[model samples]
Target: MPSGAVRMSRKRAPEPASQLGDVPERKRVSWGILISQGSWADRSPLHEAASQGRLLALRTLLAQVTPVTKGCHANIATIDHVTPLHEACLSGHVACVRALISAGANVNAATFDGITPLYNCCSSGSVGCLELLLQNGAHTRARHAHLPSALHEACKRGNSQCVESLLAHGADPDLKVPQLGSPLYVSCLHRHADCSKILLHTGANVNVGRGNDSPLHAAVRQDSRDQVTLLLDYGANVNSRDEDGRRPLELAPPGGPSQQLLVSFQGSPRTLCQLCRLRIRNVIGRSRLKHLPRLPLPPLLTQYLEHM
Candidate 1:
């Protein structure tokens, strides 16, 4: 044990709530024992097992411990309030996560720094862990101003599967952070074409980004042809100005790939099919796009809506 080890108490009373709106308040306060004087924080054997992906060890520990410390969401934590579920998700340990969830772990339980299992899983790029959390009704929200939303993390990490799962589970693609912009913009900033594509398919606003900068502008600055092409296909405004009052094309090099691509689209008309697709998508609305198949549409048209 480190010198000056001390037991820590809960920072605030737990709020018995679910779902993350504008800004999340640590919905459930968790308990932890830690060294108040050192960098090392107290962790249970269950936390160790989950973080190491030792499913069998975790299950045995779960059976041996009292119900309070048996891997429940609020049972154990580090000084920062990291639960076993948080540990498992951080390491992308699917089996450990499943076991913890089975034992009634809180998927949405946030740490002192506002880290949640969903955010951890996204950071680890684990689709399995992400899916499990969503199925358990974990709201993809963040509580700290310092951390980005789960969707933003997924986009920044370029985890298309996580992005898709988050969207399907009702993550706001347009949810903006003070410094990180929207999920779509994060995807573009990171040059994650697949993630950007997924956001557009889910009906994220093509024009939204950090304050005045657009996703197209971010893509241009990064010189990512794939991201730029995806944004253009998704109907990003070419004339959209950033806070610096420059169009995306202006940010590109004198004759770089982005500039060339922008020039090609200038004075050109989008295909009739593309125009029709955008029109239908706008009418259907973001919240209703997932239910497009259930609408009275042809199979071919539905496929177009999904892929095109």
Candidate 2:
């Protein structure tokens, strides 16, 4: 046991008729006795089994215990309110997660700190778990006081697959978390070019400055030429300034790619084609630009429009 971790004593509760309706008559045993027999960090057997990806053990445990309702009336939680579904999703155990959900676990249950299974799965780069949870009607835009959204977590971890899954499931590409800015900013800061590209194509604000620091500033600070180019293609302001009034050009290292690109953008005027693309995107709106590739245009032109 860890020094500060609390070990709670388990107590038996009456089984819900709705859950036990399918079971045949037999000698009733206290489910709490099975959970209390081990010093397993004060977590129930279902939590331990789900975390370990033990499908058979999870099924047996679910058969014995009452199913969790949508309101989390019967789901097991640790001292911090971390549930079995949280454990399963954190470990990327798809089968265990499905079992728990089929047994009526609350998909949107949050811990004491507001970390849901979707956030945990995204943080661990578990695209399978993410998809399953979304299919089960998990809230895609659930915000946490301290943690960002699942899309932000995927971007921070550079998990492009998870980012795609989150975006396809209706995650807000521009959701700004306190101190984290937006998903695009986090992706640029970490040099996740693919993630940043996805955000931009999915309608993230190109000029959403974080405390006056534009994402272009973050790209320049990280010296990611690919990210910088992508941002500019999406109409990022070249003269954008940061909190200390430092422009991206000033932040770029001399003789680096970012410096050269910014200098070129400053000197050269926009071409007619570039202006047209920007105008079309603006008129279509960021929310609708995601369908640009599916429009009735030539594939090459569509690729150009999507910045592919």
Task: Tell me the whole-model lDDT of each prediction, alpha carbons only.
Answer: 0.78, 0.78
Model 1 lDDT tens row, 60-91: 88787676665553357777787888878867
- Model 2 over residues 173-204: C-alpha lDDT tens digits? 88888778888999999999999988888878
TM-score of each: 0.82, 0.82
Model 2 compared with the native: what TM-score?
Answer: 0.82
- Candidate RMSDs in order: 9.6, 10.6
Which TM-score value belongs to model 1? 0.82
What would you estimate as the lDDT of candidate 2? 0.78
**Model 1, which residues run further than 4 Å from truth?**
1-38, 67-74, 143-147
